[model samples]
Target chain A: MTDPLLSVRNLRVTFATRQGEFQAVRGVGFDLGRERLGVVGESGSGKSMTGRAILGLVRPPGRVTADRMELEGQSILNLSERKMRRIRGSRISMVMQDPKFSLNPVMTIGDQIIEAYRLHAGGAKGQARQKALDMLAAVQIREPERVMAAYPHEMSGGMGQRIMIAMMLAPDPEILIADEPTSALDVSVRTEVLNILDRLVRDRGMGLIFISHDLNLVAQFCDRVLIMYAGRIVETLSARTLHEARHPYTQGLLNSLPRLDAPVDRLPVLPRQDSWRDGGPVGESLETDLPGGL
Target chain B: MLSLALTLLGLLLVTFIIGRVMPIDPVLKVVGDRASQAQYEAAYQAMGLDKPLVVQFFGYIGDVLTGNFGRSISTGQLVIDDIRHVFPATLELATLGTLIGVSIGVPLGVIAAARRGGIIDQVARVVALVGYSMPIFWLGLMGLLVFYGILGWVGGPGRQGIIFDGMVPSVTGLILVDSLIAGDWAAFRDAFSHIILPASLLGYFSLAYISRMTRSFMLEQLGAEYITTARVKGLSEGAVIWRHAFRNISIPLVTVIALSFGSLLEGSVLTEIIFSWPGLGQYITKSLLAGDMSAVLGGTIVVGVCFIALNLLSDLLYRVLDPRSK
Candidate 1:
């Protein structure tokens, strides 16, 4: 079989602190083809760090080391910052969680997107602007001209995210990392953003890494799911098999999420365990103690 | 815009009224206390200080409109001519001071923010601290001793005295201007040598403020989400910083620079005393001590105008840098 679009192996990230070094991500491995891969974990579980590390955004004092990190058979770990920059938007892009702070406040949306396109394309200004308008329309923004002239703060959250999505997709990268992209939007706007992203991924045949803590959303949207806990992946399963997860942590997360079909009087809670290190077999007592079977 | 205009007009009116109401008896003060009452009354009438306060204010305003500021009691010269001779020197000094301050401060701030917590960043922080702690007067004295007295690499004792034997008065009150007018390369070199120590001493205080403000502004911008977004776009570190981060941080940095420019224009009295540069700082200090009312009032009005003009310029810059403001 051909190699996946992106592959990571033994990825380790450590941060130097006054209290000594602490590993944020320990021996994590994953691969992405032209498919939606969901990474679900609680806050501080190194999920976001994994995304930032892959993009080479980790700063000094926080070190990222891996035995193997490649994109389409190109060794990403050894690339110089300048070369990596060339690959960033053109080959890989990211959608930040919040549109409010993600967009540059001082610049008009059109100007910013046009600049983003020009940075990679080396095209003339007018051509870049036309391309930006086209991308805006692709993101389902009606009256792209009117929205282009508006500053980021002038647009609503949903509109701003659409503009952000438009900018990110302008370069047509092969891999798109969406870091909780819809988390900050209202419920109604959240589905719209997800749909836009889904359409872009499907049409472009790009690899999508959806980072979030919501299990239900990930199950519905992603093709494959990785359940992370305490900075390590505990289980990997097909999205269709999420309800039949073998790991207790994954099952616990599933149980914690409320379902619309069967409203419970009181939702079942996960049994507390003291030494629950990830990437280990589920304990017998914890498995047998589950309130319900898959 | 209307409010700004009205505010400026009100400030001018208040200055005029306050200028007339102060009861120092300018004639007696300038002519000394031993003068008889008749002599004092005659001197007051001659100087037009004997008129009622409101009348004097209107007369002053009318005279100003007619391109006159009356006469100086100490020198018996036209007030405008004296100001013309002195103000240029002050402006040149202030401009040099601000330029030096910004050139040094901004880069230092950028480096500090970029290498935050590193050795270079630590040193910058320490240097800014020292600059802030050292008083302008003490710093001026120290600068003169080190750069002029001991090093002997610069001029000493007199204004523009380091390289040139004596003053070469030219069309411009500023030495650099005069040298350029004279087309004398040697004089230009001499003037620059003399200006270096004094201008740097004056700039140190402003540099401290600008560096601190720039550092904080840069820190805030570095934390901004767009910076992260820019990084993800694959822009190089330098482009991410100078292009994206620098432009955003300029809003606060511009305000700090403008305010510092206003302070520089008011003059660094200690630096003026140390170098004996005939700028407004020295002029105002001498006039105030000698009770030269017209000169002191002229200096005050100039400083006040500097503040108002600087504020207006900063507001305009705010609009330009942030389109959202409009």
Candidate 2:
């Protein structure tokens, strides 16, 4: 099989707090090959940290260490800032959780999209404008011209997220790390945004790292799922078999969800166990059997 | 425009009331304390001080609007004419000082914030601290001692050298510009040399505030999520900081700059005194010392109007900088 688009092994992120070193992401690993890979975890469970580590967006005082982190077989771990910048928006881009905070408010949407594209795909502004319009249209934004001239505050939450997606995808990155891109939108708008993202990723054949806490949404949207607990992946399974997850933590999480088909008086609470804190690395052994696995 | 008019009216009223309530009698100041009671009464009636306070306020506002600010007892000239002569010098000094402050302070602040906790940041902090806390009069004296007295790098006190003094015709009332207009480069250099030290002292004073504000505003912008997005877009760190973050802070920074300029325009009294510069500050200071109510009240009103105008300018800039405001 051809090599995966991106690969990682034994990724760890540590933050030095007043209470000593806190490992936010510990020994996490995965591979992506033009497919939707969902990372599901509770808040503070390292899902977002993993995405930031890949982008080298972690500020100082927070540390990221990994045995191997590669994109197309090239070591991307610990690259100098200059070298990493060329790869970032060109090869791997990120769509943050909320477009409200992610988009520069003072800048016009057109300028922002054009800036993102021109930074990586050096071209005159006229060419960048055409590219930006095309991107806005690709994200199904009506009246790309008006949207381009508009500011972030002028757009709705859904529209803002779509613009963010357009900006991130304008350079045609090999991978798009979407950190809860739809979580900020209304539920009705969430499906619409996800559909746009799904269609774009499929059409572009770009690997997607969909970081979210919505178990049911991830089960339906992603090709495979990684269930993280305490910064470590406790379960890795096909999205189709998410309900039949093997790990007790995954099973408990699934059980805790409220279901309409089989209604219960009360959803069972997810009981914790000490052993799950240092669970064996299930990610490595199960990496090859998934639907899109190499 | 209506608000501006109303604000000016209010300022005139306040100044008029303060002048009346203060125990320093304008009539006594004009006719002298030893003048006979009949002479004092005649001067008071002539000056319209015998009218009710409300009538007097409206009278004062009317006079201000019509460009009649009464006659300066000290200068023996119309207060309006005196302000016209003295104000331009202050305008020139403050404008130069503000220019110096903005150019150095903004870049320094940006660098300090961008490098936060680095050597540049530490140095910026120290500079800002010194600028903020050090007394301007003392700074001016030290500047004079080092640059003028000891080193002889700059011309000593006053607006120009003794040789060039009053050489250039008063076309704009700004010595530098007036000298240039008259094609007198020697006078211009001397004027600049004399103005430079005082202006630099004021510049250092404003720079402390501007840099400190810029650093804080930059620090806030740097931590914003959009800044992170810019970095993720593969822009260089410089682009991320200056283009995106600095651009965002510039709106509020305009207000900082405007307020600092306004303060410098009116608040350079000490600098003017130390340098013996014949700017509005010194004019107002001398008027107040000699109990010249007309000149002092007129200067106060002018300073107040300047503050309001600067605020209006900053508001206009806010709309230009941030479209959301518009």
Candidate 3:
């Protein structure tokens, strides 16, 4: 890629707990072009924290630092809150994990989408409403006008997630960071949501940071995958070669999943190794190709 | 609607049972201990005490439904008339107090939540603690001493100053409003001055509760994932706090505010006594002391109805404010 949409090097997120300083994301680095870049890790492995840190959403006592965190060649890390807010929805936006808790229960779907669009776009109410309806239709919601007047509780989980996608993409952001967007959905609905997201990203030629713990799903959906282990990127490989990963942690994760073709009596538990925490990092240095850098 | 009617009926039944079962006798209260057997018998029959309890209850319910609450032995006026005259005084005071409380409390709470663990939060906590724990009568008395007794900054005692009493026509039974209608600026000033101190004291008490609730509600909402979404949507912090979080809390906050208002209306007995304000609290207390069961039961019933009405109002508001309820 001529110049990646987002570039980060040595990003770290720290939280001050009663026991001591705890590092959530340590020395994590990546580059995002107009492609689906997947960050795969188990719970507490810092994939979610990385997404929040990039959006400047981390609350107090949780500090984020990066040697170089830029969005399209501009340093975005640690910008003033007012300035950071400008870049948030318009330049780069985030979709939370679950739509059930992600949409305001009181607001109408139209009002929420309109509000989100107006916050960044700042146009007339009619224009915002028009834009909201268009966005809803873009996400393939039937009866956009009727759905707009309905509340979050009235919609199913799949519809709610689609509404969320519509709202997040309404501002036309350069990059969309979706944090486990389809985890709360059913298997059938999950594929539909991913398809909508995939189509939008490709249509807009926007960079996407897809965060998930489903390794196989990431391999099938993402162009590139960053395997995280204990707050650091242990491996970076093209999604096609994810199963053939050399890292012991990645291999352990893959082995833990029960495969249908190879019917096993008992699925193997991942026996974690101590070296995964602070071992020599497996990926190449910052200066490398955007994808398939390994 | 049926539940509402049933709830009120149950409330009236409980009050009626309590009145009848109490040691004080209604016939004795009217005929007195020295009355002859004939007078006592006549009074008992007139009071419907001689009839079956079931019959008496139905009679009382009929009387209440038709707006006849009987006559007050203490005030020598009809029970309905007495309530009509005095309830508004308490209504005016409580409304003003609640207005003061909600206006100040909500913003204080939002600020405290936004700056949690900061100086403003600490101040709000202390204020709520003091207002919640402090005795209202003592607060009223102190208010009288500093503002009325010492500084003479406000009118002392009663709903209006002696000079302005009965000067304005009883249009709405609210002196402040009546004075305004009469174009009696002097009376309005006197009524306003007299009401301010007591209203402020009640307002302070309510503010404590409102602010505490608002803060907790805001904190919970602030932590919600939707709030994160709002922030990520590039909304100004003010918009996120006031428009999104505050709007969500308004549902529960309505209940808090309505309950506080209702309590202030019926439960301002201490403030009324300290200030010698001839409101419902004072009216009920005076009648209760004189063993005037007619007046006492009537006042109690009115307060209960008002409480129920306030609850109904809040429920209606819940439907208006929360989409899920609808």
> Candidate 1 residues B1-326, lDDT tens each?
77666765676677676666677666666668999988888888887776787687778767765647656666667767777777777788788888989999998898788778988789888888998898877777777788887898887644565447445766767778888887888888877887777777767777887888888888899999999988887777787788888988888788899988888888777777777777788877887776677777777776776788888999999999987788
**lDDT tens digits, residues B275-313, model 3?**
888899999998988888878888998899998999999
lDDT of 2 by residue, B1-326 (tens): 78987888788878987888877878887888899999999998998888888898888778888889999999899999999988998999999999999999999999999988999999999999999899988989999999999999999998888988778889889998899999998899999999999889889888989999999999999998899899889999989987899889999999999999999889489999999888899999999888888899999998998999998999888999998986
**Model 3: CAPRI class:** high
lDDT of 3 at B240: 92
DockQ list for all candidates: 0.63, 0.87, 0.87
Q: Candidate 2, clashing residue pairs?
A: none
Off by over 4 Å in 1: A123-127, A145-150, A265-272, A279-294, B2-23, B26-71, B150-152, B157-172, B178-186
Better of 1 and 3 by TM-score: 3
Ranking by TM-score: 3, 2, 1
lDDT (10s digit) by residue, model 2, range A214-233: 99999999999999999998
Alpha-carbon TM-score of each model against the true structure: 0.87, 0.97, 0.97
